[model samples]
Target: MCKITSELNDLRRPSLLVDAANCGTEAYQRRRDLRRMLRVAIPPTARAALEKLLPIEADLEKRRRMGATTYSFARHVDILVALLAEARAFRAS
Candidate 1:
């Protein structure tokens, strides 16, 4: 879990992207994969939060493809990180 968080932190670095389109792509994919794992690992009670976050993350990716600004990409990363934190907490509980 700490390794996942570290990967996310690396993805958050602005220097990772040469352009906005790819800024969140890798992180988005990683997050999606994590979401899949989390859905099963986390308790059923926390599934509602996962459901709410999924579409938001998808939209953020869409925005990125649509040429969202670097700041928007950064914000997207922030939201993913928060979602991961929420999932981690749910798993820990």
Candidate 2:
């Protein structure tokens, strides 16, 4: 998981999950600072890919609601894994 997420999780409850950012208390303010830093640090080329997570989250929620699969949450974990891989690639480059 991302460092930001790891730290944030310790400050709150269950590990932060996509579509569950609103779960823990003070989620709004707690995430604000980290988001501010990310807005500045994230590469422009990667911004589009990150933006696409929103639609994907909606899709996951839809699947969960319709009982499309028992692994919808697992898919979210996969998404983070893929993102971490890409981020590692960025560092290597």
Candidate 3:
């Protein structure tokens, strides 16, 4: 005899067992992906904004390379957030 399973059966177990979404690492990876996506989406006008922003990140990377203090990375991250927010706002307008 052939049998069929229902979606109701699929939901019978606790959700935590069924959910496969990676949270912590997935979130970090997704943030990186969003940043990459934004870089690809930038227009010529916005490239100026990105160019202004990239120096801070480059400085942070330089510091990391030279084994300097990590505190400065936060500022770079903040600038990236602000740049992305401005881009999103521009798009929303």
Candidate 4:
């Protein structure tokens, strides 16, 4: 006699389990994957905003390397904040 197993029987597989250490690592990896996907999925305008911001970020790093004054750093910080806000708003649209 031939016997067939019900589909319901296949649903009895073991539950997914994650340890504390691996959980953090897995979450970080997932975030990296999501960021990579977003980079690919961003619209042209959003990508342009990112492109514009990249040089400012690099310039900030350069200024930091050159021991820029606190005021200069603060100004750069404000510019970065505004750029970030503009990018967020553009993406929302």
Candidate 5:
């Protein structure tokens, strides 16, 4: 007899999806730092929600909401490295 799988569970492969909530927590903090470093105005009280929302938010909207330009966030390769590193560090468990 042969069995068929009805669901695809790619997350089972495990690069980091084990603790999504925790990763989200870190991503949230990194986003806040990114906004602050870029001088984007974010309400102190809204930090948590913003952090939680940043990853899924469209890039354009995220930039608009944060008031950051591509020049500021990604113009230089160095900045991109730092930003990406920070993001990865935060998301890493």
Candidate 6:
């Protein structure tokens, strides 16, 4: 799977794993494969949200070309930490 797909999988796993109906678990069972989410339902908000990754990907690619080792391992925990912080602020408003 591509890095984008893998990362999206990580982002999706928690809620998606629990929502069998949303994921079309039965329909894609035989065709179970990477990015299977594409074969079934992709949440209405998902497209716009995922489009944000393109810029992030481009930034990371620039870092890659510049030989930045740390960029290769952007930990999800760190991302989640930042996301939670933003989420908290969003909730406050």
Report the alpha-carbon TM-score of model 2 versus the true structure. Answer: 0.33
* Tens-place lDDT digits, model 6, residues 1-93: 655455545543234223532334333222232123234443233333244433444455466457777664333222233223323333444
lDDT of 2 by residue, 26-76 (tens): 233313422342344343443333444334544665675677855456565
* CA displacement after TM-score superposition, residue 69 of candidate 5 (Å): 13
Instruction: Summarize candidate 4's per-residue lDDT along 1-93 as a digit string, tens digits.
Output: 111112112212112211222233323332243244234443346435455544555566567667767426444543344344434545566
lDDT of 1 by residue, 1-93 (tens): 554345434443233432443443345443454456345443334345555555666677677777866437555665566456555555666
- As for lDDT, the candidate ahead, 1 or 5, is 1
Ranking by TM-score: 1, 4, 3, 2, 6, 5
The lDDT for every candidate, in the order shown, is: 0.52, 0.42, 0.42, 0.41, 0.36, 0.37
| Residue pairs whose backbone atoms clash in candidate 2 | none
Q: lDDT per residue, candidate 3, 1-93, as tens digits?
A: 111112112223223322321122223332443356345544345434444444554565567557787645444455445444434444454
Error of model 6, residue 34, in angstroms:
18
**What clash pairs does model 6 have?**
none
lDDT of 1 at 18: 28
Which model is ahead, 3 or 4, in terms of TM-score? 4
TM-score, model 4 to reference: 0.37
Maximum-lDDT candidate: 1
Model 2 stretches astray by more than 4 angstroms: 1-44, 80-93
Per-residue lDDT of 30 in model 3: 26
State the lDDT at 79 in candidate 3: 46
What is the C-alpha lDDT profile of model 5 across 1-93, one tens digit per residue? 111111111112123322433344434454555465445554343333234333323343346446775523222222233233444544442
